[model samples]
Target: MGKLLTVFTPTYNRAYCLERCYQSLLRQSNRNFIWMIIDDGSTDDTKQLVEKWIEEDLIEIKYVWQKNQGMHGAHNTAYKLIKTELNVCIDSDDYMSDDAVEKITDFWMRNGSNNVSGLIGLDADLNDNIIGTKMPENLKKSTLFNLYNKYGVTGDKKLIYRTELTRSFPYPLFDNEKYVGLAYKYYLLDTKFEMLLMNEVICYVEYLPDGSSKNMYKQYVNNPKGFAFYRKELMKLPFVGKKFKFKQAIHYVSSSFIQKNRAFIVESPERYLTVLAIPFGLILYLYITSLVLHK
Candidate 1:
């Protein structure tokens, strides 16, 4: 009960920037958290740097090195190992605001309940710009799906989950497919609960050129099954509207075609929508093909 948060960072060959993340954790005003670093088979000096940090014992540091799995895979491992009541992901390229842990636990302890999922907080760029629109002033809680599709808030937001809730829904790891959408699990949880919204920025993000968000086309090419699975799951969600499901269906069709899954027409939940999307799906298929080939 002493530790309230586990600040997890999943890293793969990000040694150069990893120190920055570690230093930020060291500077946190509150030390009531464990910094868990899951090293996803980095061939660089990442292992040594983490070891040195552990030896110094500046903060509670837990290090686990596993075979190279993509970001989602590392996330799965982190969720399993975290014993804290609350958890948040601080990407290797990102760091928390010095008081992030304090702010999060303070809110949770004051008002959090098992009735809700956890907390939904903000993420800011290095320049301190909130990534998307701020949470609605009157709103107190929202699910991941509704906050975007309903409220029209755009851009990435930091999510802090009750570790138990997150652990209950693990990300599926497809063979040779390391790129499952992390949102897949978040959306699944949305059906059961909502998160208390905190308008304060919890984490600072830096989108490097090599990050997953930047090279998505390549990801779609390399991990079509993952993308297809994500889209298919979205199509099955009961809460989303036709418009949202329609978009998921379109992407599902495209990803299905990427895998050359001939049964996509039959597999789709939105039969007519999938049929209509075929033409657009084909265009998207070709567009992705060109991008993959050109790169």
Candidate 2:
């Protein structure tokens, strides 16, 4: 009965670029959605701008502000507040196609079921080309993990999650670490249920030089606690294969060393694998250190 979808945007110090996302929402042919902005302690005029839009009353808006905690923390706040049946994330720098909401609601109303976790949609660039290969034409539903590992899907994609299911996997915030892989939640969700596959393009993306995607090396060194948590979680997934677990163990070793946690091998979910990866992890640790120092 309430709004069917909440398009939550987590932003920090991007008042200049936030308006484009606002304008795109304003143009939506279907406005059966709420625009919730998680303002991660922006010192800029982000709050003031969102207030002005609230006054305009053109769309539903819910804005919350908290001390800077990066994207994962912002997501933590949004999920706690969202009570809608469905939800999706449109980054502060990205916008949706005008009919994106219309298409999502229409499709879900016709086909959505609680048995599935959510829907998977496509993300495209500003030029309107799909960012990755389209969803497999014959596959009606698939886990997010299988889509990549089994079907060879690549590149960034848009995910629309069931609000409750998304809320079930809150990302663990580590001390002194503000960056965690957002996909950490998605991968966990993959272990529970499959998502309905939809080939429709839902949103547009443009990676900024300062965005996490562009600056992952720094994130790797600075957020070792968060990265280690992500890898440890992935290692525990029951559906993951040994090869995947070995790769995760390697990264886990690397992150643990960065965090100065020396007993990582003994504590690993796959202990023997972690022991095997120790040498490679040492090399990776040095490589990461050199990269950070080189920068």
TM-score top scorer: 2
Off by over 4 Å in 1: none
Q: What TM-score does structure 2 among the candidates reach?
A: 0.98
**In candidate 2, what are the lDDT values of residues 1-295, reduced to their tens digit?**
6789999999999998999999999999999999999999999999999999999999999999999998999999999999899999999999999999998999999889989999999999999999979989999999999999999999888999999998887888888889988988998888788999989999999999878888898999999989988898899998989999999998999999998998887778889999999998989999988998998
Candidate 2, poorest ten consecutive residues by summed lDDT: 168-177
TM-score of each: 0.97, 0.98
Candidate 1 local lDDT, 1-295, one digit each (tens): 5898999999999999998898888888889999999999999999999999999988999999999889999999999999989999999999889998889988999989999989999999999999988989899999988999889898899999989988876777878877999998999899999999999998999999878999999999889888988888888888988888878887888888888899988877788888888888888888998999998
Q: How many residue pairs of model 2 clash at the backbone?
A: 0
Q: How many clashes in each structure?
A: 0, 0
Question: Of the candidates shown, which would achieve the greatest lDDT relative to the real structure?
Answer: 2
lDDT of each: 0.90, 0.93
lDDT of 2 at 273: 92
